[model samples]
Target: MSTIEKAMEQLNRSPGNAESVKPKLQTDELSTKVKIATAYSEKIEDKEVSVSHKKQKTLFIDDARLKSLGMISLNASMSERLVRDEFRVIKQKLLKNAFGVNRQETLANNLVMVSSANPNEGKTFISINLALSIASEQDKTVLLIDADVLSPSIDECLDLGEQAGLIDYLSGEIDDVGDIIYPTSVPDLRIMPAGRAHHMSYELLSSDRMLALMQELANRYSDRIIVLDCPPLLGVVETVTLSNLIGQAVIVVEQNKTKISDVKQAVALLNSDMNIGFIVNKAVHKAGYGYGYGYGYGYGYGSKGKNK
Candidate 1:
């Protein structure tokens, strides 16, 4: 048997203990170094789980609610002109990094994540808005995944009803990831809610199942962009584990809110090899300072969006 086949066989036969079952990374040959408890074996079977082939469930989003959140205009053209312009610039950088330009290959560009040093820093707000903008792209599709299993807010933000989500599939409550991925009323945009919070959420996120699911998402569609709204980088074990599965990381820092020392620590949690960037959530729109025509929030893009 080939080396990969033998490794798979060994993985399947071993007790599901975190130490015994090491899942291979989807993007690279190395395995995850995060130690995950093996109790998930009861949920995961020997057979491989396929996500790309399955049909997904569809959910409707409330446009009015999104408008109230300043996400989009009533006419559905990005609500705040300033917000839209800023995000346009941000997404441009991200897309170029994802698809590459002029034959230059971008590394770990498709799988992008939005995180922060702490809660209430507007990471969720930025994540949802970024997904919305990316969905507007002509050729690309976007999947916004709520990786914050501890305190999920995507469903609530989108005004969605209770539904089975990522946790259900990871815990084996559902056999297919397509069942958990919900296509939204918004065209070209889909979402995966955090689902029922599991006590072993951290472990499950770092498990073989999680790795398999991420691999499927990353490789299934060449033009697909996954925007993960992960938990805070510091003080969250799950976020650090989830970071290993993605290619690029966008750290959101609130102006005058998140401390500089905290931001440093949060960035340190991610793998050094990954491409990392920042987005200043709230900034004052002054006379100059790169501020364009008047808009909302005075949100500034600092040091490539590093807050002042």
Candidate 2:
């Protein structure tokens, strides 16, 4: 069976009626190719086009390097195949929620934040994989942002060199939004590494400048999706502050690790304006059932401290 079929089969086993998930699920039918606007500068006719949001910088990434890190396979292998298919299922759901007919009314539904209640629960793992999976799409582009200023991992995971990011733009260290965005060798995938750490990260993330940046990102290209790797919700004030600005949230709960109370507390901190969802990470795959990471749908855009 295809990945979506496997996912549907898995969801059918849930307590809620299986029919409820049919509308939310979608196959990988790519729409017509959309023109990709550059986020960085690109030369045309040898004359600088005044850097009109058309920035394209390169970050070399190897498929071998990625697989070594236990990420989804871009090539071929049983384990790699399974992981890739798994994320395909996950990303399809996310994309539907962002652009589906019944998508949430949030203005910035394309802006998604992937976070967890505690550290080391594989939140980063899921974030990176999700970005990669989305990038593989024929009709979409992705920006994997490292919003975890204090403990960013996107750069390190991809073996990128030191670079400026969201903080640099918000703090006035950088003038152009294009300056911080780095395009990866992966087609349709770009990233913004966490810039130089600042003691006032929370203040800066919640600043008016940050809000404007989000607006620009949201209103830019319709096909562009921004995935943020945010800090753990319970301990970091930045996560809560940043949550208010996003239209969608994905809370990654490590199976058998994160406490139910902690997950509830973390979800409580998010703004209800978002379409919140859950990802059960690090679960063992059952034979014939495929890998078993559950997707839980939590009610309400703004949470109120309840677990699903």
Candidate 3:
């Protein structure tokens, strides 16, 4: 078998306790490293159960609720077409990275994370919109995961109450990952809530079980794209830990509000080998275009080495 196929087989057969291939990071030391990088002024679910037989939970999102939040919804009107087109461009780039001829097959290119340098930069907004956009694709399936365990808002954004999800599975509270994956009103879109908070969230995210689960998600379906709504890159060590598993990242930068230094610092912590993209949230275009979000995709700031 080819190396990629063998690796996929190994991932499929690997038990939950399988050792994580990614190097472990010392929280305190990593935190210190992040701090210094900033000071330098720009330096820097184990489940055997099958999903087919299980009766999955359904997540119902109100169109009005989405409209109130200024998010994209199904059956978008002419007025919402602009935002949809914007995300169409964003998702096309991601899909190309995940499955295009130039794509990296070994890495988990199908798994993508939507995050930001700091909180309230509209990462969640982009995450949901991106997932919605991809779901509209005729041949693609999307899973929207709320990985911001520290402060989960996806549930609220989708008008959902507290639900068992990533935290529950990682903490061994939930055995079958399928149980936590909720089918949304949008046919091609599914969601996994952030579950309850825990003091050991950082450890849980970096555990072997988490790694195994990621492998499973990445290889489960050839056309599936997993989009994670993660915490801000700074302060939260869990976000950094989660970055090690995914193949791509989209960092949201709030046009006038986000600081360039913070963005640089946050980018410094990401897996350099991964394809990192940027989204300028709440941007104001001149004249007819009015105010809207902007997006751009590219490699890391510099150097070709993966973040270690």
Candidate 4:
């Protein structure tokens, strides 16, 4: 058996305990560490569990969640074209955006909205990729939920066919949320697909089941930073329902692409007291600072957005 296989078998034997899953990082094999994970960043901490390399609080994903045969959701594959030497720089910037907040108290308040004034605004790419970036960073756990029930992009991102996601839990069809959660190839990162498609996505999100599921996740995975990939606030009522679910929501706008009227309307709908942020995706800038390829971090309300 290969080393990875052996590790898997050990992991399966004692799945609940945090110690079983962490395999030692062989510093002898590689001088520079490729990744650094911690239980603190992800919000899971287990003291008894001690392992070499970066220590991460383990998760109890459904058996099928991590399975290979039917695994629908897959992470973006690393390409040879990427400059390996500078990859860490990109990851660092993403860490700042996903987790960075106004104050220590606001860190947990940094929620994101995966929306645009219209469809095809590159919201899904930003949502999923940002989630992945945070997960790949050491010790942080990111829960990517497909709140875009009207039209889900995670299905394509993970390439998983038909069924299993939030809709199931919301509609009273799925008994266990664990059954629907899929562990991506990336560590410290997991995804909950859009579940089965439903015509009334807005109704589903407002149901008792939906609220229960969110509460359960928040209570159990207190350390995790949950990112809900919601629908476009302009037309979808699902985004409004999600507003109550998350403390903060963000809208993704394509610069010079989305109509100003649409953005204004969406902002009004999401108005009043809730934490809202925007990511100016697909916008051209004169280059403020070369922080690699990903977008830089900006927390809370800013002049760059319509809020001011």
Candidate 5:
């Protein structure tokens, strides 16, 4: 069975019943080729540009990344417009709130782990896009990790080339996590895919090695922020484990789809107090978000420019 299929089987057996494990999950960086594939579309043919640049790789990534990457698509010009009109407005609010809440220092060190109460909550999409946005900012380095060992999303997102990563390192199949890390087209951004799922991979990360790895990562990238895209929290042990590792988390609640009951239960399951805010995902157009033009979030990268 493929890793995804195997993960499904494991989910059935585990059923997110284990008590919250200490240490947690969060997630991206990717190659230019990989990023274009993952961030753009699942279908290569969807891109009008010449795929002939197999060796061209990524020329460069935008300076600023985004939260809802899959929300809009356009030629480079259109994308830039989208970022200016849509992203900039909300981000200013995020920064102001961070400073106001006395979390000025915490937001800098935050290893935000994004997940939902269930699947298709746009957690994976949001997590990946957010990492891209962070990396774009000057002096800020961002690492996006596919910590969802049970069911990896980065590979699918980026059309990955690596055969192993987080799972291999945690299971002793690999020693150096560096071997698995891939740099994305975006400047200062890197990715660590949850290696192919093995037996009890959720349990595997709880081990001391995994804990050490996370600590090592935090120390190595003390200046950079890390984001984890994890399995849902309500019934997943790994998500709980991730919450414990990082003092902060962001629960992605998809509008309309997620039930309030599950959200309450998942929060109860998590023992961490780090959740800074609730990232409302897949939300419909609500007022107060001053996007002069309405963004129909039919919901669902990179370095070199300024906010001007």
Candidate 6:
């Protein structure tokens, strides 16, 4: 009555095949054939997915190009050396907080956010420099995420073209996060561009998915560090939202430009328990020879500021 029974009956009725007619297929045999076909199909599907992932582009950051952009490069020039040394000191403290004995005190100590009181305060500059510095570490890798979706600049700064990135992953536009995280020419550096701008940038940043992604990034690798280039804290609700998910915060204060009140207010909006640091950008010493930069580490509003 069933299809298998009908096929068996036809095989038995065949004229010359009567002698060759085999016993009816056991249920397990039929099931085994179906499983083999399903497995073959699954293998084909997996191969297609793997091929698509292999097509994801790698971001190429030219050292000469970075030099032209006035950013630190792979060169060994004196000025570049000084800049690298400065970030070296900064990254040391960050690395200490990320993986040191006190690391257990912070929720996501490996996740650091670089932001400013307002835009054009050299936050992006610090973010890129910090990431580059960390990438140079012998025992660690860094993933720099452009989280300033409203005014993304990492791609432009690195001469990277538009591509799907953090937003694409957070908004469910891309099913896999690995698809947007691009490898770079730098040895241990990776980058996630701010994907296509959306009207609900704040909502997306504050979404549950964003929090889950942050948790995954923080715990994914024991030797990996994540640096988020966040928007200026003032007037950006998204930055405040992001502060909650990060374990460390670096506020870049432009010398003679950023207001003290703005710094206090921006700091007020951040997670009070976070390890906070300040970078005085473009500060000039009494001699007025070259730009003097200073780093101060603190905790919460009652921070014991120690300049390094």
Clash pairs, model 6 backbone: none
Give the TM-score of each candidate: 0.74, 0.75, 0.76, 0.60, 0.63, 0.74
Candidate 2 per-residue lDDT over residues 1-308, each given as its tens digit: 42222333343344332223221332233221111112211211122111246755798877876766657656847634555666777777668767778665436678889998898777787888889889999999999889888888777767788888888887888877788888888889989888988889767776667656766786677898899998889878867866765767877765556676686677777764355666656444344222332322211122232223
RMSD of each: 14.6, 9.7, 14.1, 17.0, 16.7, 26.8
Tell me the spans in candidate 6 whose CA falls farther than 4 Å from its real position. Answer: 1-55, 283-308
Taken over the whole model, the C-alpha lDDT of each candidate is 0.66, 0.66, 0.68, 0.50, 0.51, 0.68
Give the number of the best model, judged by TM-score.
3
Q: Name the weakest run of 10 consecutive residues (lDDT summed) in model 2.
A: 32-41
lDDT, candidate 6, equals: 0.68
Model 4 collision count: 15
- Of the pair 1 and 4, which is ahead by lDDT? 1
Choose 3 or 6, whichever is better by TM-score: 3
Worst 10 residues of 6 by lDDT: 27-36
Residue lDDT tens for model 1, 1-308: 42223322332343322223222211222211222223433333353765655676678887766655656432555324445555666677667657865312424458888998898777788888889888888999999999888888888877787889888899999987778888888899999999997899877777778866776676678898999998888888767867766767777766556776786677667765555656655433333222222222222111211222
lDDT of 6 by residue, 1-308 (tens): 43222323332342222223222222221110001123223333322111124545779998976655445578858644556665776677678767877456425778889999898877887898889989999999999999999889898878889999888877888878889888899989999999998888777887666766776787677999999999889998878876776777878766567776677778777655566766655533323122233321111112212111
- Evaluate candidate 2 by giving its C-alpha RMSD to the native, one decimal: 9.7
Looking at model 5, report the run of 10 residues with the lowest lDDT sum. 299-308
